[model samples]
Target: MQFKHPEILYALFLLVIPIIVHLFQLRKFQKESFTNVAFLKQITLQTRKSSQIKKWLTLLTRMLLLACLIFAFAQPYTASKNQFNTQPETVIYLDNSYSMEAKGEKGPLLKRAIQELIENLDPEAPISVVTNTTSFSNTNLKSIQNELLQLPYAPNALPFEAALLKSEKLFSNKPNSPKNLVFISDFQEQQKPFSKPLDTSYTLHAVKLKPQVESNVSVDSVAVTGKELGKLKLRVFLKATGPTAGTVPVSVYNNQTLLAKATIDFSETNVTTFTLTENHIPNGKIVIEDAGLPFDNVLYFSLNKPEKTKVLHIHHQDNLDVSYIERLFNNPEFEFSTTFLNNLNYSVIENQQLLILNELTTIPSSLINAIQSFIKRGGYVLMIPNSLANLQTYNAFLEPYNMVMQAGITSEKRVSKISYAHPLYKNVFEKQETNFQYPKVASYYPVKANTSSVALAFEDGKPFLVTQNQLALFTSPLNKTNSNFSEYDLIVPTFYNIAQQSLKTARLYFTIGEENSFDVPVAMQADGVLTLHYNEQTTIPLQQYFNNKVTITTTDIPDVAGFYQVQDKQNPISTVSYNYARAESKLSYQNLENLEQVQVSSAINTAFDTIKSDTKINALWKWFVIFALVFTCIEMLILKYFK
Candidate 1:
């Protein structure tokens, strides 16, 4: 047992006052005469024994009360044997992640945690404090208390296992002392489990904070539908974390103007599609009002005006499929042009988004080289076969890309199946019909190539339409003389989708803290440098330029999730959007069962008690105060009734 204020114990000498008063009262009393000798003698005999017993008991209680009061005022406590020899080395892992913004009993969970830490920590002991992004080592509690109070919520989070390992490393070379690690966090369930067994040398403590509310809703992702020219549609994916079911108000905005608003019943559906009639919106966002966790309630997205896709059709002079090809590429979204293989311009090949070879008898050496260079620079090509063409020239042209044209033409095949899930067919149809008509080809060459996917296959298990990287090939010509493919309903969509997929545009959205890279089609010429703009601020990101293509990488420009634009000086080249990570939207937490080798406490005060218990220092001041009051009450009762 130890007294906090041991010098105050000198007041124990005041116990002499009670002893002196008892001694004075015990001095020789004057003899009193009794009215009757027999009655006086009996009264004297009975009263004397009872009076002596009551007086001694009263004196003992008074002396014990004085001692208890003194002990209570001195603030006595018992310390473990090890505690007296050295101070404990404590490391506190405080979770400052955005999830810690949850409200607790007193205030924000983080504020309450800081208050509890300040009140319970040993002032004299040197401590270490670690947050998600920063740490301070070998500092006293008083020195870092202000910094703790001012610590802001961090955008990133650290797992419990990593924090524990960091704490272990911090104490590796420290002087020998009783070691302790206290982890104060909400213990979100997304944290990965410990990979290996923990070191047993240091004692571990956990303080888990509980959120005031249990329900949360978040925007999971956004996807664009249909690349048409008029109105654009966005599909927003939302998820509810708890069992609550109700209507949530969702709104879409372009820049600062409100475009559309709707209320969705999340109990029935998790996806909502919104269409914006306003064309050419460079920046936009969708917001939902959710008070439980507002960080993930808003999703940002960007849209570029549909650019005209430049298509170059290279074909033979007598090709019969030119009319069908022209009709497919005549939409307002495409810049369609045609040229014979003999008169093809190599300079124009670099400017085209797609190239179509319509039943050509032979591929020129220079044309094949230009086609290879075009595909390498993110261009698409579609080829149609000529049954009686020069197979040697075609195979020689394709051999460098691991592709070949077989010599024989088969006349007994029809397209048996279609890969409806391929990106080439995305958003082409509302729904796939089971009994759709299949296109039949009278004659086609069996292709031999290492292709990425077979878009359409023949009944004999041969590929009808095969795609190798950026190149798409057909085994049969589209002319009416060889097959009915030119007249089939599938030909229109097949050619239209290829033209649509060739346009280069920014991605729909990116997640914050994830690496983002964009490929701009504009060349870096003269003194032109790429700059990104968010709100009113401008920043230049890391950029590399080659062959009229500028690749930009953003390192530290965006600190928050929102819509941003990349430009060369004043010309806006592309727009992109960023959204916060959705991992924290999952409010599931870890219980004691999830953490195996650590002591856990839900309350901060309880955690302090656990630490004290580990050191064998049990506080006795409260017990002494209670005992002092009880003894005083007993002495008063004896004095009042016994008299």
Candidate 2:
């Protein structure tokens, strides 16, 4: 038991005053003679003894009554040890990710958690609430009640470790303060295992909100699986959790018009395909009817009108085997052209997206300056060194990229290693092919390269092809006498993707909360800026202006998933789509009960109750008040009834 105002306890010393008054009676008694003194003397002795006992009883009761009143005024209470001296600090981590849209016993998990927090939390206690995208620090529940009620779901979920770190940072630095870190989420299983933090300054409590049913299906992804003359066959990937069966209806919409509708037989398959006309859907949406999670029920994608990438090849007039360059860029997606070094039109260099210097013996200083400026303006360049190329001239052009041309190596080396994870081959191959026919080069120049820059290596681990930002270099020329690389199957994707990436056009779609960059081909004034528009919402994305295009990079601005129009003020350039990632669609969760130094519960209110119990105060002052009243009644009975 502890006293709130212990200074009132000094009044206990006043009990000595009552004892003094009882022992030394201040009232004087008169002695008088009366008849029958002998019998009267015996009766007086009995009366005096009984009266003395009564006075002692009354004094004991009165002293206890005064002590009880003093204790009651002191406001004494019983509570957990050290709770009276420790200050409590609480921080709550609320997971507002899309997976929280799952239904619990009450309602949506996020919504129910919010309601419980508002209902159970101390209205005036200082607390901090950490969400995925926002934080309400050092605030009371009454102040952030409205904000918690309207909190929206985030596209990205904060990692469990990150959330723990964030919660700890919000706590006060005062030592020995009782800190409670409450984590309220569904405890979804992530790609990596949760590393438990070892900090002992705070107590960790986890409330795992489980859904009523574990069965849920989600639209995983949409991709063009096949293509024909004027139609594109798209496949929709679906993912299910637990035991889900039966056919689900899927619909494809272009703007407000329905393009096609189909049903996927879940009992037999997890995929369905739909064929639509080419160049028809500038803004496309694929939706599935599911009663599970709502965020992944629909997928958004954009297929804008195609733009041909410009390719220009500069070669020496003496070289006659330019068949490989011509055949690779012969598709309808690229506008391929060639020119001799003597006939190089410097005026057209700025318009081309990719420039291939095929077998150039000497790079003129004037042409080198033009190519350098072109590359600096977001253009790509591929350098194929001639067999007898002048090293001094080539080294001057390669000096800025931390590369140089070395003397030729007269050895036959086969191209055996491919950096399968390079951006050039991101999705080019389904798996790493180890048994493909290796292409051999009879004689080649040896150029040093950074370990990360080597996209393809020779059998001796020398760089056969190295690529830096906006530049790709081959150690040797591809002429039939020097190498047979032009005849192999590896040359198509290598050269084709270079031209394709140079344009930076819109992809099928992009995921939100990721670093997404693309180019908008529009000439803007020096002060002009680009903005994204989606249903009356406009946001200016981070953009870098170039000669004929603007490179736009977005991470967290356009948070909603939908088709956004890339606009220069009001004029539209193109359309791009953003969609939430499908990571939380499967509904797998982690079991946190076995974690060390953490208390696990299944409800938000229960977790709060545990925290409340830690600092709960059981006031003994009311019981003391009742004791004071009883002592007063006992003293009155002794004074009135005992005599």
Candidate 3:
């Protein structure tokens, strides 16, 4: 019990005044004659005894009544430990990610959470509310109630650790105050678990809002699987949680017009294919009908016009067999050309995507500078050293890439190992093959590089092919007398992917939170810039201007998932697409009950009630007032009826 005004309790000392008056009498009675000697003695003795008993009873009642009144006036109250002495501070972290779109018992989880928060929290109490994209700090619920109701879902979900840190920062710096952190979310499990423990300063109350159903079908991914005669075959991958069966409808649209529709049988397979005319649909959209989360039902993608990669090969001699190089890049996808070292045109090198230094005996200072400049502009280089090349001139170029060339090794080495995990060979082979045809190289120079740089290793653990960023090196020449690599099966994919990487075209779609960069084939003025347009929104993304293209990098901008036009001011260059991350589409949740030092509850109301209990005050002054009235009645009965 605590008191509002403890000084009123000092009034108990004043009760001593009544005790003193009862004990010491100011008036004295004179001796009176008795009617009869024996009768007077008996009457006096009985009367004195009765008077003494009555006076003691009345004095005890008066003291008890005065004490009760003093306590009542003091306004004593009982509450939770220390709740009456400290101010309560609250910070709420409301997860407004797309995963909250799942339906609960009443409605959508996010919508229902908002309604309950407004209904349960005190209107006048100060609080801070944090969400994935927005926050209201040190404000009352009445002030931000409308904003909470109109909150939109965010494309990216904030990590649990980040949200905890943000919530802690929102708390005030007052000492000895009771602080509470209410974390409300669906608690979706991510690829990485929340390993960081929560802070112990504030009491953490976690509310894990669960949906009624766990079954959800999401469009996992879309890719260009194959190409037919004049059409492009696209594969749509779908994922489902819980017991899913039967067929689901899938549709493909070009802008707003429906292009094709199909059905996927979950009992048989999760992937379905659609064939559309090549380059016919610039704005591609794939949608699925599922009674689960709505945010992942549709995926947006773009298919811009194809751009051919330019290849330029500079050979040592004009008569050397360059037909093999020509055959590799002869397709319509690549612009292939060759010239002898003596007749190489320096001006044309700036516009090429890949440069092949075919068995060059010596690299001039001027040509080396040109190649370095080309590489800085995002060009790729494949260097095949000549058997008798000048080591001094070669090392000069290799030094900048942290590579060195040693004396030539006359012993023949066979190329045996392939780094399948390397980006050049990723997805090129269906399976890992242990036994295959090996090519031999005679009279090869030994190139030493970092262990991670080796793409193809020789039988003796020497680097047959090593690559760094934008530069690939072949330790030996591929001529008929020097090596048989040109005749091997590995030549096609090895060269094809290297050229493909040189000109990184836009993917079908990029996730909103991942690192994505693509080249837009356009030349802009020094003062001009590129902007992404979707509906009425325009965003200026991070970009670097090059000679013939603009490299645009995106991470967090263009928050909406749709087809956006890449424009240089008002002139539209191309189209790109973005989609929300699929991490939350699986409908899997984390088990938070095992957390220590934190209060976990399944319902939002239960979590809020726990917080209220900590600060709940039970006033005892009313009970004390009733006790004072009862004591007064006892005092009146003692004075009137006891005698």
Over the stretch 168-284, how does candidate 2's per-residue lDDT look in tens digits?
899999886888999999988987655458855888898999999877888888888766888889888888888776888999999989999999889999999998885558889
Q: Give Cα-based local distance difference scores for all models.
A: 0.79, 0.88, 0.87
**In model 3, where do residues sit more than 4 Å from their true spots?**
4-63, 192-199, 318-321, 410-422, 425-464, 479-490
Weakest ten-residue segment in model 1 by summed lDDT: 190-199
**Over the stretch 396-415, how does candidate 1's per-residue lDDT look in tens digits?**
76786677778767576778
Which residue pairs collide in model 1, if any?
A: none
> Candidate 1 vs candidate 2: which has greater lDDT?
2
Instruction: In angstroms, give how far residue 450 of model 3 lies from its true place.
Output: 5.5
Order of quality (lDDT): 2, 3, 1
Give per-residue CA lDDT, model 3, range 289-391, as digits (tens).
9998898999998888778888999999755787888999998779889888899899999898899999889999889999999988878899989888999
Indicate whether candidate 2 or candidate 3 has the larger lDDT: 2
Say which candidate scores most in lDDT.
Answer: 2
